[model samples]
Target: MPQTIAEKILQNHTREEVRPGRIVRCRVDMVLANDITAPLAIKSFRAMGAERVFDRDRVALVCDHFTPNKDIDSAEQVKTVRQFAEAMGVTHYYEGGNVGVEHALLPEQGIVGPGDVVVGADSHTCTYGGLGAFATGMGSTDIAAAMALGETWFKVPPSIRVELYGTPQPHVSAKDYMLRLIGEIGVAGALYKALEFGGPAVEALSVEGRMTMANMAIEAGGKVGLFAVDDKTVAYARRAGRSGNQVMAPDAGAEYERVVDIHVDDMSPQVACPHLPDNVRAVDEVAGLRIDQAVIGSCTNGRIEDMRVAAAVLKGRRVADRVRCIVLPATPSIWKQALKEGLIEIFMDAGCVVGPATCGPCLGGHMGILAGGERAIATTNRNFKGRMGSLESEVYLSNPAVAAASAVVGEIVHPSHL
Candidate 1:
């Protein structure tokens, strides 16, 4: 009768013994929305005639996706969220200069934590699971309901246990590990199921690496991706200025619908080619494939570690003359840190455009949009057709090392080539 970590967290919030498939109403520790989702949520909140949020301090609004406002329409959309945050007296609202991708910012700000239930209007809200939180995404209306009630109902999902058996090889990072999982599981492999990453290898991943793993869980159709709260989680939470003692893990006898074990040492740099996250292949498989653009940022693979790797690969190298390389920090704080560390200067010196800490170009919002028939190699998550621009364009997803190396050569290549 033991429960998984996801079940335990959800049960704690509901104050009840819960199991997969059981419907339960749980209190939410955090509720988040971005420029794109907040407007619809605000309308729903107003439609409910709710003048006050269940807990103003618990609700956060971030203007990341389309901020720095791509156009008047985007500006007005963000303005709506801004006004709503103001009227509601929400203290966590962030915009302009301070804005960051919600998934990345929430954890960095200490707004999400272990054993908490966080709901955001972003699929990658699951990213908080890296800290052992029970977090997930929902439609704007559902988010609005959470805003009004500070709680929502959920059908607890069954769990899938992913055990990492060995340490990753150098330069073979969590991004590569995740792509391998997606390739094995297919895009819909874990549909509506909790993906619990555990075992020695996962325990060895840095918080940034764990974040990259959890952030892409949705790409495999997972309801949530969770890592047990270990010393690494505590260290990360403490570093983010939060008490990190909220340790939680699945019981020894916890049941899982399925278990998949991966030997990380056997893996290499991987990329999800155009059209699907599960369409993964090794770096050598696609090496020498031409590309017109290369981007190194997103909620996935945009941490300082990612930046450092890209900078290491591009230190004295120039981006290929025909290629455009763009670097975006996931959060303003990370941006400033990169600046202090001179990673920004290194990128600019290598002929890359150091962009604002927005979700720019990740979702085709702006900054590095590709033209027809163009192809890009990016460290960002997702590579579906038209994900970063025209439908005729293609996106190949990889880790920052591959992204940086490709930027230099104007072709998909591995860091070893540099």
Candidate 2:
């Protein structure tokens, strides 16, 4: 039987003919956890009486969330992870200045690559699927087991083919296309299913853009978001110093539960309003809605491409009075690149705060929390209640360009408007 990209990867990992809904034990290529979750996994690993991980090189621990020692509790959390890494001799550990958001950092370092089966204790682990990997998030407990055994069980997910057919307009991006998809399908639309993105439009997106789309797959209730390996995938792996030959693609006539087609030629910049990621609207619909803050970074849109877009819009302008604009680079390397490219200078001149590489404020941890009744426009993925601070505060989700343009006007607006 022909298999989809996700099914092919699983079968390659398990050496079994895996099908949708079949429970299979598969060897994982990489396992990761962040400071927020690694401590719990470490405790569980100890409880399981595992003295060493199955393979230290395949296990990664990142301290991105609430890092820079946010507070006494967060500092202690990092301390526990650091101590555990030292004791375990874990080779892929990252923290302090070396830390980046786990999702972005792993792929950039070639730690997770094409056709790999990766599991992380963070939901956005699906981001690796953009690299043609079969990646998904698991609980800390499951992660501990994977770290100890180098294997985990998964019920193979049926695939949903999301076919894209046209080029996005200026200032529109994968974030907008993803938001439009979520709006059309709702949050539970693809529950427990693999979303296999394809077609000419999707092929045209940069790897960074593809990752941004996959990073929000969980928001649509997807089990995993996958893309077929292509030249771009190979080039990206090569740039990351990975020369692995583990590339796979869906066979023709592969099965899919359904197909969702999106024609993006005329698609406008999209936004998700407060309370849910699926509550999306065209940027014009919410134009003039005042915002108290505008955040231009996160795992979703904190790459170098995102930074350049935001900088282009803010180059000759300043953030509007009373609106605090914060720009965060997802990793130390990206931060340094931005500085070298003078993107940092543009942001600083525009009165935007350039923060370190952390998940900051996206999870309401720190850096730019909102007060009650205030509003923010962010490039972060989620906009759930209390996600960025006070429950009463609102979040509007958009691409980097929209967020930057909104910052200039002190309200939600399309980049074209400014």
Candidate 3:
């Protein structure tokens, strides 16, 4: 039977005939949990009477959510995860200076690669599908079981083929494409389905861009977002010191639940308005909407490419006097790279605050919380009510370029307007 990339990966892991809707137990290549979720998973692990993880090297514990100890509660949370890691001798434990956002850190460290099966306690774990992996997020309890057994059950999901045919225009990015897609399909459009991204544009997109797109697939209710392994995938794995193996792609006659084609030649930078990711509009449609804050980082857009784009826009311009612009680098390494590239200097000169690597403020954790009635434009993924602060405050989601441009103008605007 013809199979898609997700199906192929699942079949390879289980050595079984896998098909959509079939429940199969597959070996997990990597299992991850973060400070926010790891504590609960650890509790469950203890309840299971599992003293050690199935494979210490395959388990990762990241402390990125509320790290730097936002408060006593968060501090205690990290303490629990840290103790668990030490007790288990987990090889991929990360915290303090070594911590990076779990989704970004795993790929950067070569802890996950092509055709791997990865399950994490956070939804954005789907980000690894950009590397041609079968990755998904599960509940903390499910993660606990996976850690103890090195295997998990999955009901194989049908696939959605998203074919991209044209190059994006200047200042437009994969974020825009993803927002546009979510807008077209609505949040529940691809529920429990794998998103197979391909076509000419997929090959043109950078690995970082693909990662950004895959990161947001969950917003569209996708089970996972996958791209076929190619030269770029191999090179990315090589840079991370992994020999990309088990590389797979869909068969020529692979079946899909549905097919959607998106052409981006004339597409504009897109933004998601308050309350829902599917509430997207072209930037021009909402230009001049004053913003109180501008954030340019998160797991979604916190890569080096995003930092360079923001720096290019903020090079000599200062942020608006009343608008606070905050930039986070997602991981310590990305932060250091930005500093070496002088992007940090540019941001500081522009009056933007450069924060440490954390998921801070994205989930209303801390650092740049919004006050009631305030508005923010951010490169972060979601814009749900109270996501970054007061329920009365609003968030507009955009790519880093648009967020930086908005910061300079203190209003939502296209990068070209700057």
Candidate 4:
């Protein structure tokens, strides 16, 4: 009878009790769309004959995907979407790196909170679960309808409880532990279920680290992923302009489909090999793999805390002569924080390229392109083929610490070694 952060949020929004396999209608507090998906969502809403959005304040249009418009088609598409939002009188629209990723941008602002049923066009919308929101990704068509009706249908998802216990070794990160957990569960093991991360190991991670873990839950096929809003949540809330609020949590006897235990006392760095997320291996096994570039940024690892760790390695040291290391902040706010913390100067002194506060190489649209058959290592999510910048290029995924150490050595090396 244990509860999960996801369940608690859903229960708050529950107009009626939902049993397994039953469809439930819930009020959506916010609906989001981005460049890659916003056009379709806007079109669908207009087709539905919505004279105006259900609530202008409740709908957010972000242009993170193909941002800065890599080409004319992309630019025109954004222009059209912006015109539509303006016509609808929606003021929640965010453009350029100032907006950042939807999930990252929304939560970093006060637009999302506990017990809110937030829907987004992008699958990683689940990242908002970090704050105890009933956040889930939906198709653009569904998002459009939600924008008009302020409600959506969902089949109550089953639950998977992951209990992680123990402390992280030196230089280890939430990314490493999550990679190991997903490796054990496989990419599809948690499909259609809410993954609730818990136990001592989870508590040990900083709020930023917990966000990193929850942000990538969709990669493991989870419908949503969340962590308890404990003191760490309070800390982040204070930073985000919210001093306090009644947070949400699950009932004491809440039900779950299954529970799994993960131990991290002696765990090592974990890596996701190319082509798939579940393709995992120990970092030692893949060490010495030559890398042409090292990227550190994204919604996954682009926060100020992440920059502090990466800078600790890069400060007073130089990247490998043959490697190019790019560091991008996730948002303008994060970029400002980096400057205030002197992390930006450290990166520049280390010869790392400072990029605009954007998704950058994380989505493979631009930055850090490798030659065909060339290899690169990055702290970004997904090492899938062509995920970095080149179709024939190979990529390896690791935590920022490993990426920094590898940049210093010009090959894969655990950060603990340095």
lDDT of 1: 0.90
Per-prediction TM-score to the true structure, in the order listed: 0.98, 0.99, 0.99, 0.95
- Candidate 1: residue pairs that collide: none
Q: What overall lDDT, based on C-alpha atoms, would model 2 receive against the true structure?
A: 0.93
lDDT of 1 by residue, 1-418 (tens): 7889998888788876698888899999999999999999999999998889999889999999887899999999988998888899999999987788778888988888878899999888998888898889999999999999999999999999999988776678999999999999999999989999998888888988998999999999998999999877887888888873666789999999999999987788998998999999999999988999999999997888889999999999999999999998888888889999999999989999988888889899999999999999988888988999999999999999999999999899878877
lDDT of 2 by residue, 1-418 (tens): 9999989999988876799999999999999999899999999999999999999899999999998879999999999999999998999999888988888899999999988999999999999989999999999999999999999999999999999999889999999989999999999998999999999999999988999999999999998999888888889999999996455678999999999999999999999998999999999999999999999888899999999999999998999999999999999899999999999999999999999999989999999999999999999999999999999999999999999999999999989989
Model 3, runs deviating above 4 Å: 244-247
Predictions in order: lDDT: 0.90, 0.93, 0.93, 0.81
Residues 1-418 of candidate 4: C-alpha lDDT, one tens digit per residue? 3545665565556676766566788888899988889899988988999888899999999887777777899898899789988999987898874677666678788788655789999887887777767788999999999999988988878888888989878778888878887888888988988888888998878777877887778888988888777777766776777755564556677778889898888889888888777888888988888888898887778887888889998888999898899998777788888999999999988889998766657777776677788777777777778887678988888888888888889988888776
lDDT for model 3? 0.93
Local lDDT at 18 for model 4: 65
**Candidate 4: worst 10 consecutive residues by lDDT?**
1-10
Specify the poorest-scoring 10-residue window by lDDT in model 2.
241-250
Ranking the candidates on lDDT from highest down gives 2, 3, 1, 4
Query: 109-139, model 3: which lDDT tens digit per residue?
Result: 8999888999999999999989998899999
